[model samples]
Target: MALEWVVLSYAAGAEAVMLLLLTLPGLDGLRKGLVAVTKNTLKPLLSVVPFCLFLLMDIYWKYENRPSCGDEHACTPSEYIRHQKSVMKSQRNALLIAATLLLYWLLFSVTHLVIRQQQLSQRLEKLRNED
Candidate 1:
């Protein structure tokens, strides 16, 4: 569980860095490379959607069927363990949702950039033709 948190933290940090790099000016050359990678990786990135749904369902199920933890003094050892497990499960599900959201953001950014580039090219072509 601890390791999952660490991995999720790193993933979130990397996504932030990628977004920063994409938005920074004076990096037009890097932009192309980033977009290319984004486009190529999109198909695989889509695989996250189903996994995210699964995580969400699992979280819902856990929430709906969770056993009562009762008073700390009255809680059995097994009940305490079950409560801890539920807490960990919730954390993992939240992390998965965050990662899925980040993936979608990256996809949207890449598609928007591609469309803008195409529009610019078309406008330039029309201008040249009018010359």
Candidate 2:
């Protein structure tokens, strides 16, 4: 369980770093290489979307099947602690799932835009040279 989240966290962190690198200013020279890397990474990152959905369903299933600690007054200290921990873990996982998906989307969008901008710029330069 812990290992799964650890892996997801690492994936999310990598995507974030790559995203930050892509959006940084004054990197026209580096942008080409970064865009290439991002294009390659986009395929692998597509997997994250489905993975997040699966994890989200797992969280939902666990939530539905989770044992109640009963009403506040009736719950024992141990049961209350357990319930609180479960809720906290669920919330954390859900947030992580959302973040991973969002980063993937942003990465795809930004990479595509960069590629398109490069193509348009090249076309414009060619036209200027022809003139």
Candidate 3:
């Protein structure tokens, strides 16, 4: 459980770093290499999608199966504390999940745009040289 979240965190962090590098200015010299790396990485990083879905379903299952701590007649003080902890954990995990998905989407879109711009610029340069 903890391991899953750790992996997800690493994936999210990597995506963020890649996205940052892609958008960062003054790396024109490295732009080609960055674009290549980003293109290659985009495929593997896609695994994060299914992994996120699994985590989401896990969250849902846990939520449905969780013990109700609100029953005053049933839940002890310790149980209530545990319930609060679980709820907090779920919220935090959900936020992380959302962030991870969003980062992936942004990274993919940015990489595509970068590649398309490069292609268009190259074509324009070729046409100019032909004149």
Candidate 4:
């Protein structure tokens, strides 16, 4: 059981590393091919088969060896509520980070387009003046 948990954790960690690598700018040259491969092969395999396997594993582990609740009668509901609040806060922070990155990328693309258009216009004007 411990070995299975360890292996599953490792697989999840590896998948996370792969995701991070996909996000890096330096890997853009190969990203299209990678995306193709992921879309054609890995995506379906991981999303369907591995996900179901992992879900089953988790359910089995949780059911077979449930964590003991220390003095459940005395357990504070506030603590669970606070934990949920913290999780929500963290999710919000992640969303903010994603939004900021998307905004930066959008601004960069717009600026690049404007610069290219200006250069083209300048070239056209110069040609007209020469003629």
**Per-model TM against the reference:** 0.64, 0.94, 0.96, 0.43
Model 4 quality (TM-score)? 0.43
Candidate 4's C-alpha runs over 4 A off are 1-75
Q: Sorted on lDDT, highest at the top, how do the candidates line up?
A: 3, 2, 1, 4
Ten residues in sequence with the least summed lDDT for candidate 3: 68-77
Tens digit per residue, CA lDDT, model 1, 1-131: 45644644555555566666666778877777876676665566566566556666767887888777666447788878979987887977687677756756775675578659867988999999999
List, residue by residue over 8-53, the lDDT tens digit for candidate 3: 9999999999999999999999999999999999999999999999
Better of 1 and 3 by lDDT: 3
- The runs of at least 3 residues in candidate 1 whose Cα sits more than 4 Å from the true structure, single-residue gaps closed, are 1-17, 70-73, 76-85, 88-92, 125-130
Which TM-score value belongs to model 2?
0.94
Q: After superposition, how far is residue 113 of candidate 4 from its true place, in Å?
A: 1.0
RMSD of each: 4.2, 1.5, 1.1, 11.6
Expressed as tens digits, the lDDT of each residue in 7-110 for candidate 4 is: 44554444444455555668756765654543353433344334434645555554456333356534467765765565564455344334433433443344
For residue 39, model 1's alpha carbon misses the true position, in angstroms, by: 0.8
- Expressed as tens digits, the lDDT of each residue in 1-131 for candidate 2 is 78889989999998999999999999988999999999998898788888888899999999999887666447778988998999999999999999998988898898898899999999999999999
Off by over 4 Å in 3: none
**Superior candidate under lDDT, 2 versus 3:** 3
> What are the per-model numbers of colliding residue pairs?
0, 0, 0, 0
TM-score of 1: 0.64
